[model samples]
Target: MSDDLPLTAEDVAEIAAILEHSGFRELDLSTRRFRLRVAKGDGAQDGLTQEWQWAGASGEIAADVAGVQADPAAICSPLPGTFYRSPQPGAPPFVNAGDTVGEETVIGIIETMKLMNPVHAGRSGTIAEIFITDGTLVTKGQALVRLA
Candidate 1:
């Protein structure tokens, strides 16, 4: 199976139930041609539950504690496509290191199928780092910026 394979809500619910019963905070399943990882809880006071499912040929999954401050900054791809920072041929970037960003700020753009999608800062933070350079491909849930 591949990531392109269609999945249904029933599949998700069944997987969630399995995880809930097993007392495994995380679960990853993979076959010869497909793989996926599902995790529960965001480790915040509200404890938001988030699950990530990816299907592809040959994949791996591991379990980790939630809310562990592994990285202060996080980069997220607004959309799935190629990510570009520079405006045109040899233009300065919209943002650089040591820059502060508002919650509604436009950080970058992801080009998908000839359309430019604007990326924003999900939360207020500083541009601690840039993970990708100009004209780099990005996938969904892929980190793009790190917050301070």
Candidate 2:
């Protein structure tokens, strides 16, 4: 129910039960820490197939249910935390869309457990997109920026 908390096994089961009663063939839910996919088996006779994946760990979507494209050149978060685009409030962001950056460029900062860790551009490239906004919670290995 909340973005900070991942769904438990029981929660998923309850959702599946609801889906079964509702006559929906499939359900895909993505939270900050996990992605849950449920689908009924073929022919509507077999039970549902449930798949759970850590959101940013494998960096793979079992099914592209949302139809969003993944950026191959994305700079991912090193750990789960709150992402900040600037050094401090009201400051200019480290990088913007179309900005050219080197491998060592400090693109942003991720605050985890009261520590601020700088997020770097792992490779040199022009900033193609900024996916996460300032001060948003991000999962480990979540795509923060895309390079062109």
Candidate 3:
């Protein structure tokens, strides 16, 4: 773990797991070769903690809702990560553009750092549009579904 050495995948995973197990919310480590950061959040599941924001080859790690407007009735990603429209592969999507959802309905899951973060519809409405494809990467505040 020297500043002059690049961290391997195992190294990063180990660090993240350790920090997560310790109930830490954030981690910042740097070396002459690379700089690494890990973020934690209390996900929508409530009480199930340890959601890390790590941007591997994606270049920039961001997890704040900002800078983008699709529709007044859009549901945005609460965090940055891979957006999965279904709970698992080859499964039906949680919702489609014309589907209706309730305030607490889960429209999708955002996968970050091996954690599945559920994205909910904050308001009850019919989805007017779907802005993202299944398994695509989504950024915080980037609208994924638009309400009618």
The number of clashing residue pairs in each candidate reads 8, 0, 1
lDDT of 2 by residue, 61-99 (tens): 332111123467999876556799999999999999999
TM-score of 2: 0.54
lDDT of 3: 0.69
Model 1: per-residue lDDT, tens digit, 1-148?
Answer: 5545655443544454345435678776665435556666655532223344344424344333222332446867644567788666587787787889888877888776566777888678789888988888765557887877
- Candidate order by TM-score, decreasing, is 3, 2, 1
**Weakest ten-residue segment in model 2 by summed lDDT:** 60-69
Which residue segments of model 1 deviate by more than 4 Å? Answer: 1-72
Per-candidate Cα lDDT values, in order, are: 0.62, 0.75, 0.69
Model 3 Cα shift for residue 67 (angstroms): 5.9
After superposing candidate 3 on the true structure, give the runs of residues whose Cα lies further than 4 Å from its correct spot: 2-26, 36-70
**Candidate 2 ranges with C-alpha deviation above 4 Å:** 1-70
Alpha-carbon RMSD to native, per candidate: 9.5, 13.1, 8.1
By TM-score, how accurate is candidate 3? 0.63
